[model samples]
Target: MRNVSRCGVVMLSVILSAGLASPAAAKEPSSEPEHVGVLDAAVESLTGDVYAEPSRWRPLSLGTLFTEGWDQAWASPTRGSGGAPRQGWIGAANGVFYRLGLAAYSYAHDVGDNGDEHAGTLTLYTPFSRRFELRHDIPFVVNNKGSGNSYHTNVGDFSIAPRVILSESQDFTQSFG
Candidate 1:
């Protein structure tokens, strides 16, 4: 019990002194609005459910390609039975997390307004350390559509990466269950 009290006192003193000594901490509240304003604008412009929609609105047969920045990118093209083809694209660059990106695809046969679909993505990223990093501008939303009762369409994905790597590395893998 005595040891616990001592530890508590030490922690409290350290926290108080650190706060008092930090200029950034003292000035932080005033600048918080700027960050909030920027985030509001971003949230307003990029709207919708990112997962419910396909990345591409047009077919790959139409020769549509998405172009963006040096941060990130995602593209997926797929074909299945009794449905149209699907394509997706996602990407991001500049600003907070350095760069982040994402892309995926799904195809349905029949229903109502749903059919085949695909999506691509690009992500820009920034790292805080070798074992941790941040990602932003997550999903740009490449394409989305269907012939039946499909309700998938949205854009703008933001994320953070503890560790970043490329497809060449085994850090990323997928499994179906």
Candidate 2:
């Protein structure tokens, strides 16, 4: 189409002009590793602090809380199960998606009278190819006697499920093995 041709030409010209106007990148990287990093180190030496830090970062010391910028690191509270594993179900279907995954989740016994039963399971999904996938589940389970007398913790059984994907789509994916 004429319009598509014109758009392509315009894009090509813009890209070529941008390349010509800008300085060429260095063949060798800087000894300092990074430019902005060097500037940050300079500023930190002169001011004893940085203008800002990444989110979830905590201050190094309370004495310098307000004086020194919060540059130290702190792990996020919601990163994992948040101390207590989540009790829920999750599912996904489609294309290449994530080739591998690691997840931690918990389950509870719902059947007849049983002491509080909880299990923390680490589920790993490994895809060997677009059509083949393998899954492994390792669990650490525990049961606390309602009698207020004892508790048990043990390494639960492991499982493996090999799947062969026949078709995959946004709404549907069929697999069997």
Candidate 3:
């Protein structure tokens, strides 16, 4: 688990460094104002392209992983397709239509004997309209402990989050649940 965490950190650092180095390599001046950071610049570049030409945008698909056809499931919702920009303090929704996410976490503890814990969460987000969205999370957990190496597995608490977009603008977006 520690090694995995370390690897993730290293990968993130490499990606950020690469983005930061690109601006310096270009050297040419741009018409747009400078951004505060590489992440900010990247975000602006992506959102600008996405918002500017909605028709050109292609939905991401999983190639029949969850659906029968090539473009049936996992298609990104169009920006103006009955939902807001999908951006706010929560995070970029990437698509306003629907989204599915899976995340895993692991940890080692030394309380009495060396123990390890792992958890995986599956989340689904669906936007009903411009102002409202529903999110559900299901989690599973595993624990291993003691010299006997006993293992315990169980389902964690499931949760639902309802989000509302209060305000949105070119500068920022605000939302709450």
Candidate 4:
């Protein structure tokens, strides 16, 4: 623990010194067109694409929370069969991509003169393609009964799902997995 604390302090000091030394190293602002409205500005900032077209704009889904790219339909000149755009799977941004996410949760309970219990979970989401995604969870538990104390930890379940887009229009999109 002492070594870990020393390492953390050293890393923080380095970072702070580097930032302070580069106070004037900021990039020059470019002459780009300003967004039209509040919503447009917010979307542009979040997507990191100031030139994204409004016609191809889509709402931010679970998948797009990590990355953004060009729509598959516009990637090629030819449309899908029947001249309709190829709708990607649910949570997709209309192209092949992958994303990884980590999240943590904790719960605690206590009862008078009885015992105390605590639980924690760590979840991971790995989306490997436009159509398939995987999810896994790991959990641990602790309990204190009066004077005696016990701790337990274990792995949790995992699942995979393949998604498909059923129908999509300018205003609505439906998908299933």
Per-prediction TM-score to the true structure, in the order listed: 0.24, 0.41, 0.42, 0.32
Residue 127 local lDDT, model 1: 39
Q: Pick the candidate with the highest TM-score.
A: 3
Residues 49-160 of candidate 4 have per-residue lDDT tens digits of: 3223433333334454234322221111123336665334543343422233444555556656455555555544443322233444455433345344544344444444
lDDT of 2: 0.44
Q: Least lDDT summed over 10 consecutive residues: which range in candidate 1? A: 168-177
Residue-pair clash count for candidate 2: 0
Residue 25 lDDT, candidate 4, scale 0-100: 54
* Better candidate number, 2 or 3, judged by lDDT: 3
Better of 1 and 3 by lDDT: 3
lDDT of 3 by residue, 1-177 (tens): 999999999999999999999988797444323323434433333333324333333332234223321221122224444565543233445223344455656676654565666667677665443334567877867556635677667888999888654543333434566
List the candidate 3 regions with Cα displacement exceeding 4 Å. Answer: 1-98, 107-114, 144-149
The full ranking of all candidates by lDDT, starting with the best, is: 3, 2, 4, 1
State which candidate, 3 or 4, has the greater TM-score. Answer: 3
lDDT per model vs. reference: 0.35, 0.44, 0.50, 0.42
Cα TM-score of candidate 4 = 0.32
lDDT per residue, candidate 2, 1-177, as tens digits?
999999999999999988976654534333221223334433432343222321222212234333332221111112122444211244444222123445555655642465456657676655443334567776756444545545567777889877654543333334565
The superposed Cα distance between candidate 3 and the true structure at residue 113, in angstroms, equals: 4.2
